[model samples]
Target: MSVDLPVSSPTWVSAFLDLAAEELERGSAFWAQVTGTTLSAVRGAQHEFTTLVPTDGDDHLRIQRRDAGGSRVHLDLHVPDQAAAAAYAVELGAEVVRPEEREDGFVVLVSPGGLSFCFVGQRATTRSRPTSWPAGHRSRVDQVSIDAPGRLLAAELAFWRDLTGWRLRRTAYPEFHQLEVPSSQPLQVLLQRLDDDATEVSVHLDLTTDDVGAELERHVALGARVLASHDHWTVLADPGGLRYCVAGDPPDHDVPA
Candidate 1:
């Protein structure tokens, strides 16, 4: 099942954190400081929506207050033609949770693995300058990692490949794969097969940093708890108890094996 996707059209992907209403303020504050961005005035009839305004580029992060479940992160794909984009995603096995019609419409979809994402009409033109870390810290959220049950790995990988058209490559680690987006895109998507029997798919954000130690320290001061430390990456939980990682750059698509 294929829908015509214009080769010339650009797609912009952004990330959003959805937290319980009770944790919205704390979660919003924590993410704002971590990303060096400010929170916009809360909008939406329920006052559950806010955007993280970066100092330079377009805001790629947002905060939403949900009624249930633990905090989780999801992606937003911005394209010029909302209808076509959403139609193609449905054809790729996504279930449409909400449909859209107007130019500024929003279509919510859940992937085969049950992970949620949205397609928004029109590209975000405001490009912020690359993130500027504090005096000693050099890091930015350059990729999002999706953890899927081992049993569903193949189907999950195929769903994302069809949706984004990003080139997929195997990593040095057998359990992990990288969906390499074009250099023009701001974020990469990593798919990791879980060893446990868990059947649900979930996502976590990752930051690439030059100095993991220094960056970890900064995060600790900002109320992030260190869960574990490894040579390549450090596991951390924010004030809202959402887990994320800070790591050195991993191999890229152009890198030789």
Candidate 2:
């Protein structure tokens, strides 16, 4: 089916950040990304998952969607200083969404486009060893992907291409294009054709599911719509209309040993 998407680049634009991944703490990372919290799990999987509680008005973390793509694919970077990082991000044309604040020795920040990332005030005391994947183990975050209006594809591509100097990675599917950038994590930015111009922002937290069909049924019970799918993945919109995906394909990164 034909979909509407962007085909031109924005005339005036600035630089974007190239994010990198470090196996710091997945639960910490997950909590950071999902709820904007900087705490690690008290007792749980440390490498592949993280959790947090809500206080004040922060209860929105669990149910609320993080992005339109369902999972965040932008780089999770570690920086030496939050203030310096904020300064550099501004210099690079990223408007501040969250200012640097100390919490567990790291300051978390989300980019202008709602990409969640962190800046560290101190270095990690220890580094994680790499892991190789078996047939179906939870692996490192391969890449976070997004879907954009097809009419905005050219504009979006121009913005990112100039920023990263990376070329577009095409798939057999005609609805989207992917861009790979430099980062320890296998990240891809997806430009997808949208049916409505009313749809603006794209962000969602992705969860791995063994069966997209079954997951979609579960989500339908919870309240969401199946948006799109392919041989490897299926997209769904949460009750709030935020989009995300459950995949049948193996992840791009290997599992840590």
Candidate 3:
């Protein structure tokens, strides 16, 4: 099936950290400290949703309490028209997992490779701001890296490209490709080709820190443990066992001094 892509429209990309219902309080507290944001009142029929209201910019981050599924991160693409965006995603090879309508007009869809994201009507305003660490810290969740099996990289890349109309660029690393969203957007997404036979798609958040060591220590104090350390980035598992990374400056943002 062929679906024509729509002209790039005003879009806002936000990240949601999903955790088991039991872990919502713990997760919310941890994330609030990590990002220097305060938690808003819990919403949703089951009181399963909350936003980490930032001090400035739009609130581009949220936390959800899920009854099933392991803890992980997902993206919410807010566009002018939710229905049109959802249709465009279906044309690009996504399946609607939940067709239920929300008063806010958002639909949940999964990518060709199984990564779950949503399309929602554009928000009236966002309080998103660049990563500004607390007085002694210089780190924030600024990027999301989507890991796809080698076999699905091409389709996944094309899907995201046509969906966001973001500038696509290759990195020095052969397996890494970037969908560079506008600087005005809060978070950037990177598509990574995994060197494995696995076909499922998963995502991890990336923190851009001026001092990896300091940030690592801070996160460890906040309940994250180091899984691995690399020259440019360090992998750490949150209290709930979700793996994320702490790296140097983001390509699209200025490094804090």
Q: Model 3 over residues 124-213: C-alpha lDDT tens digits?
A: 354344455554546667789999999888889998888887768999888899887665666778899999888688888888877777
- Give the Cα lDDT of each candidate: 0.79, 0.41, 0.80
Candidate 1: C-alpha lDDT: 0.79
Q: Which candidate is the best by lDDT?
A: 3
**TM-score per candidate, chains pooled:** 0.89, 0.47, 0.90
Candidate 2's residue-wise lDDT over 31-87, tens digit each? Answer: 343222344344322233232332221111211123233333333334444576556
Worst 10 residues of 1 by lDDT: 248-257
Where does candidate 3 stray beyond 4 Å? 1-10, 100-102, 122-127, 130-135, 250-257
Model 2, global lDDT:
0.41
Model 1 C-alpha lDDT per residue in residues 62-136, reported as the tens digit of each score: 888988988999888888766787777777788889888564388888889899988886466544543556565
Query: Worst lDDT window (10 residues) for model 2?
Result: 8-17
- Candidate 3 or 2, higher TM-score: 3
Q: Rank the candidates by lDDT, best first.
A: 3, 1, 2
